[model samples]
Target: MPKTIIPFGPQHPVLPEPLHFSLTVEDEIVQEAIPGFGYVHRGLEKLCEIKDIHKMIQVVERVCGICSKIHALCYCEGIEQMMGVEVPPRAKYLRTIWSELHRMHSHLLWLGLFADSFGFESLFYHFWRIREKILDINEKTAGNRIIVSVNILGGVKRDLSTEDQKWILAELKEIENKLEEVKDTLFKDYTISKRTKGKGILSAEEALYLGAVGPVLRASGVAQDCRQLQYAAFSELDFEPVIAQEGDSFARMQVRYFELFQSIDLIRQALSKIPEGPISVKVKGYPEGENVFRVEQPRGEVFYYFKANGSKFLDRLRIRTPTFANVPALAKMLTGIELADVPVVILSIDPCISCTER
Candidate 1:
């Protein structure tokens, strides 16, 4: 069979971000796939040198709109560690609550996009509708919907009041009920299963060798999650990593679908056990050394490296987003799959080119 090269992105109806993939196909089956980047670069990391460390918090939140709070959380925690500032207990719980809310919304957004990738338009709309509630919670509590700038160096800038917590819980309950209603369609629907099950199989070994993270790694039956690091109030919470053995598109969807409820449970746990105290602490000195921080984002583990020189501005800032780590696994999964299934498989990894290229 003669080989053909097909460009699969940079502007596809199914991709939420701009990601380009060179697909080499033989008789409509993918023989190899090479990913391309550099389509979206904001130079946010480079701005650290010019922007004050405090101002960079808002900048980091723009790394990826969907996982904004987690990015800011990772950056803030790294800076706080280097400065020897401990976050208040109440602030820690508040951070956890907001972080989980971000996670739920991100996953819901991905789920909706995933459904759309395979032509499930109604399912897509349904998922996004449920996601609006989570975004509303963010706007109500943190003062913004997507890029909620709630994280600060010492702790969180916003606090959830008693009435706010009650309202959030009530909203979450409704979201949970809505998710349950669509659970069958997401998992058992013939079309979804046909488009997802056993497609883009990335075995456990492939996942680790390719450095997969987040749902992509979990779907491969890896029980590793950065939340196990005990950051924020995760140390006080109890939950298990959602995993599946198939390591296919269906498995990836399953892991994310189940994680929606897990995030809700985490928010509930944090709110229930939240202690009363100041939301933020005063930092006394400038950071002088370098430190690394990792946080579980909706997509995967986001790594932040901070270098400081006892000055107001950071010397250097580096970020390793999960999409960058998962690109290799994506290429591996793409190989040996039918070209028609490309969109389904690509979206399965939940690529965020903005996060990757930034």
Candidate 2:
């Protein structure tokens, strides 16, 4: 069979971010894939030199809107580590709540986008509509929707009021109900399973060796999660990473779909046990050392490194997003699959190139 070179992404409508992949196919099976970057460069690295450590929290959050809080959290944690600041117990729990809330909405958003990509219009609309509740709750709590910017150097910038706590719990319960309905629909609906099941296969070894993390790694039967580090309140909450053994596209989707419910459950648990106290701590002296930290973002593990020189401005700042680590795995998975299935496979990795390239 003759080989044909086909390009996908960086400008396609189905993709939420710019990621270009050149696939080599023969007789409808992907033979090889060459992925490239440097398309949407924003000079984010250089900006670290100019922006003060405090001011750059907003900049870090903008690395990706869907996981902005996690990004900010990662940045703050790294800085906190360097400064040797121990955040209050209450602040850690609040971080967990917001992080899980982020995971819930992000998964739902991805579910809608995945459905829309396959022409499942009704499923897409319904999922997105259900996601608005989480967004509304976030706006009510943090005064913003996408980039909540609620993370600070020592702890968090926002607090949940008594009334807000009641409302949030009520909202989470409602979202859980909706997720149950959606879960039933997903499992019963043949169209969705038929399109998604057994589409992309990545074995457990390949996932581990290629640096896959979060749902993608979990889907491949590895329970690897940075959350086990217990950097946040996750240590206090009884914890177990979700996993699926099939290692197929459907498994990936199912892992995320089920995690939505788990996140809802987690939020409720956090609220019930949460302690009342100050949401943030004051940081006066400048950090004088460098530290590295990792956090579980909506998609996967995100890395943040910060260096301070006893001044307000950062001496250096850096990040490594999950998408970058997953790219090599994506190339391996795309091989031997039909060209048409490329989009679903890409979505399965949940690539956030904007964050990756930043």
Candidate 3:
């Protein structure tokens, strides 16, 4: 069969970010896929040199809108470590609640987009509609929906009052019930399973070899999660990384679906055990050393490295986003799959080109 070169994205309806993949296909089966970047690349990392560490937190938060809090949290934790500042216990618990809520919002966004990729319009609408509730929660607690600049260097900028905590728990209960109602349609529906199951297989070996992270890695049966590092308040709460063995597109989706519930449970647990105290602490000096922090993003593990020279500005800052690590695995998964399945397969990784290109 003659081979054909097809461009998959940069502006494809299914892609939420600008990721261009040139797929070589013969008889609809992809023979090879070459990914190209830079369309939406923002040189945010380079800005650390000009922006003070305090201001850089805001810049880092913009790395990806969906996972903004995680990015800011990781950056703050690294800076705090270098400065020898310990976050308050109450702040730690608050971080966990917001982090889990961030995860929930991100997964819901991806779930809707993934469904839309495969032509499940109803599922897409349903997921996004429920996600609006999460956005409302963000606004009520953090004062903004998308960026939610609540994380600061010493700790958090916002506090959940008694009334606020009660409201959050009530909202989470409603979200949980809605998630249960949609579980069957998302996982067991013929349309979803038929297209996703047994498609875009990424064996455990390939996933690890390619450095895949997040739901992509978890779906491959890897129990690795940065949250297991017990950062923030995760140690205080009961937590477990969701794992799936199939390593297919459906498995990836399933992992995220189940994780939505897990995140909800985590928020509930954190709120119940939250200690009442100051939400932030005072930092006496500038960050003077090097430290690394990792957090479990909705996509996967996100790493932030910060090096300081006892100055207000950072000496070096580096970030390794999950999508960047998962690209090689995405290329591997795309090979040998039907071209028509490419969109679903790509969505399975929940690729965030902005995060990758940042």
Candidate 4:
């Protein structure tokens, strides 16, 4: 059989991020997929040399717009650990609340895009509409819709008031109801199932071997989540990693779908048990040691490595994004799927090229 190589994206209608894949195809089925990157690389990590440690928070947030809060949180937490700062109890709960809200919005955005990938336009719009509520919550509470910039070195920059908490809970109830209405259409619809089920199947062993993270690893039944490490108020909350055995595109979608509700529940728990105190503590000195921190973002585990020299600038700031870890797994999943199924399968891991290239 003659082979053909197809270039899939750096730009495509279905891809929200810029990523290129050299897909070798025999007839309609993909034989091998070699990924190409560097389209949107901004050298974010390199900026740590020039930008002060405090300014790097805004820089890290730009690594990916969808889950910016998590990036900031990871960076701040790492720095705080090195500086030996104790975040106030209220600040920890506040950070957890905003982080989960970021998770909800990120998952909703991915769900909408996933629907669009399979030509479910109405479903896409429905998910995005629900996502707008989460964005609104970010804006009302943290002053930005996407990159909230609420996380600071020792804690959070903003605090949720009593009235704000009540209003947020009411809004979450509405979002939960909206999600219930679409549950059947997303999981039980014939078209969605046909497009997603059994497509891009990756085994649990393969997922771990390929270093998959976040929902991609969970969908393959590895039951690992950085949240289990209990950063922020996750230590005080209760939840389990959402997992499925199928390791297919549909399983990936299911993991993310269930995580939406889980994030909501986490927020509720944090707000209910939130203690009264200052949202942040005054920092007396600069970070001087080396530390590594990991946090569960909407997509997966984001790892941050910090090397400080007791100066205003960091010696090194290295970030290992979830998408970077999941890319090899994505390549593995793409090898045997049909060319027509490429978009959805690629989207299944929710590739964040900016994060990867950063």
Candidate 5:
């Protein structure tokens, strides 16, 4: 078979992010992949330099809509550390509730996309219909569905009333039941298995060597989870990372499904035990230092660095998203797989290009 190189990104239909990869293919088998980026680069760090701390929170939230609150939480954690402020226990638990809520929605959203990738239109639509519940809860609780600006300097910008908590829990329970139903279908569906099982396989060692994280690593039989670090109220809760040994597109899907259920459990636990108190503290003094913070996003670990010089604006701000780290692993994993599986493999990372770029 004569080799033919086809560019597979930067604005391609298969890739949600603006990534460019030249795939050298012969009869559908990808012989080689050359990856390139730099598209959608917006100099977010420069914006941090000009935007004040309050304004910059919105900027950071824009880093990724799927993991927006996690961005705010991580950025706030770094600032809180620098300021020597311990967030209220109640606030910590509430933050976890919000974070896990986002995670559940995000993972479910990815599941729908993956289902669509395999031409399962009914599954995709069902998943989206289920996801709207979480979005409704987000809007009712956080006052915004997508870009929720709930996190502030010392705590959250919003509060939950007793009635609100009750309503939220009821909604969450509905979500959990529906998700369980979906999970069962995904696990046993013949077509889903046919399309995903044994496709886009990544060896355990190869995954670790390629610096894979999140579901990609979990699907490869790795048990490592950043959430175990328990940076926030996670320490106060009980949860485990989801994993699978198949290391194929199927395993990736399995990990996501398990994680969605786990997130529901986490939210329930948080709501049950959440204490009542103020959500924020007063940050009177200007930050005069540098710091780094990280959080477990739905995709994976996200890191943000900030430098301040006792001014209204930060001297610098930088973010390293999970997608940036996962891209290399994607390239390595795609090397020997048939081109037909590329979309499933790509969706497995749940790639958030906006997050990676900003």
Candidate 6:
């Protein structure tokens, strides 16, 4: 049989983000996968040099639509550190609630797309239908579905009233019940297991060396999660990182499914412990010096670096997104797998090309 090189995609049905791979295949087995990035570069990082620190928050949030809030949160945290501003306790809890809410929405979105990759259209619809509830919550509270800019430098821009909190409690309960129903079918379904199990295997050692983050690293039983760093309100919440030892596509899916419930539990905890106080403190003075902040985003660990020379405009701003870190893992996972399983394998990392390019 002759060896052939096939382009996996700058555009494809299974991938929502643009990622190109030159796959060398022989007898339907991939020998090597060469990756190409920067398809959607918007020069977001460079814009920070011209944009003021406050305006840079909006630009950073647009780095990845799925995890927009987390991006803004990381940027705000870094800037706050540089300015030595202490966030209100209420604002901290609010940040936790919105972060977990976004996590749930993001995981659900990935689940739907993962199912769609394997041709489980019905499951895809079921997952997305439930996701709408989360979007509705975002719109009702933050005034936007995806890029809800609730965070300012000192604290959150909006507050969740007692009545609104009660509504959220009730809504979370309903979403929990709905997820339980799907959970039963998702794990037990023979088709899903057959397609996912033993496919795109990534060992624990390889994952750590490649710097895999979020569920991808968790699935390999690494027990490492950025959330455990006690950032924001996570320190106040009682939670554990979900771990699985399989290190395959199925294990990755299981890790995310478990995280969905974990996020719901974390949200409930935040709501219960939320103290009565102002949502924001007055932010004064320009940021001075340099600092870095790391947050556990839906995909994995996202790092933001800020350098301010006592000015309104940042001297330098850099973002290290999870997708960029996970690309090495993606390349390793593709080697020796069946070419047909490429889409599903690539999706297991939940690569966001926009975030990578930014």
The TM-score between candidate 1 and the true structure equals: 0.99
lDDT scores in order: 0.91, 0.86, 0.90, 0.92, 0.84, 0.92
lDDT of 5 by residue, 223-247 (tens): 9788898877999899878889989
Q: Tell me the tens digit of each residue's lDDT in model 2 across 1-358.
A: 8888888877988897778999888998999999989887686866878888888989998888899988888888888888778898889999999989888888989999988777788989999999999899889888888778789888888888889999998888887788778777787788878777888899999998999878889999998888889887888777678889999888988889888877887888899999988878898788887788998887888887777788778877888898888889889989888888888888887888888888
Lowest-sum lDDT 10-residue window in model 1: 8-17
Stretches of candidate 1 exceeding 4 Å from the true structure: none
Q: What TM-score should be assigned to candidate 3?
A: 0.98
Q: Compared with the true structure, what per-residue lDDT tens digits does model 6 show for residues 1-358? A: 9999999889888888789999999999999999997789988888977888889889988998999999988888888887889999999999999999999999999999999999999999999999999999999999999999999999999999889899999999999999999987799999999899999999999999998888899899999888888878999999989999999999999999989999999999999999999999999999888788899999999988878898788888889999899999989999999998999999988888999998
The residue ranges of model 3 lying beyond 4 angstroms of the native Cα positions read: none
Candidate 2 all-Cα RMSD = 1.3
lDDT of 4 at 198: 96
lDDT of 1 by residue, 118-185 (tens): 89999989999999998888889888889999988888888778999999999999999999999888
Clash number for candidate 3 = 1
Candidate 4, lDDT over the whole model? 0.92
Among these predictions, the greatest lDDT belongs to 4
Q: Scored by Cα lDDT, where does model 3 land?
A: 0.90
- Using Cα atoms with residue i matched to residue i, what is each candidate's TM-score against the true structure? 0.99, 0.97, 0.98, 0.99, 0.96, 0.99
Tens-digit lDDT track of model 4 for 12-59: 989877899999999899999999998998887989999998899999
For model 1, what is the error of residue 171's alpha carbon versus the real structure, in angstroms, after optimal superposition? 1.0
Deviating ranges (above 4 Å) for candidate 2? none
Evaluated at residue 38, the lDDT of candidate 5 is: 80
Which residue runs of candidate 4 sit more than 4 Å off their true CA positions?
none
Over 4 Å off in model 6, which ranges?
none
Clashing pairs in 2: none
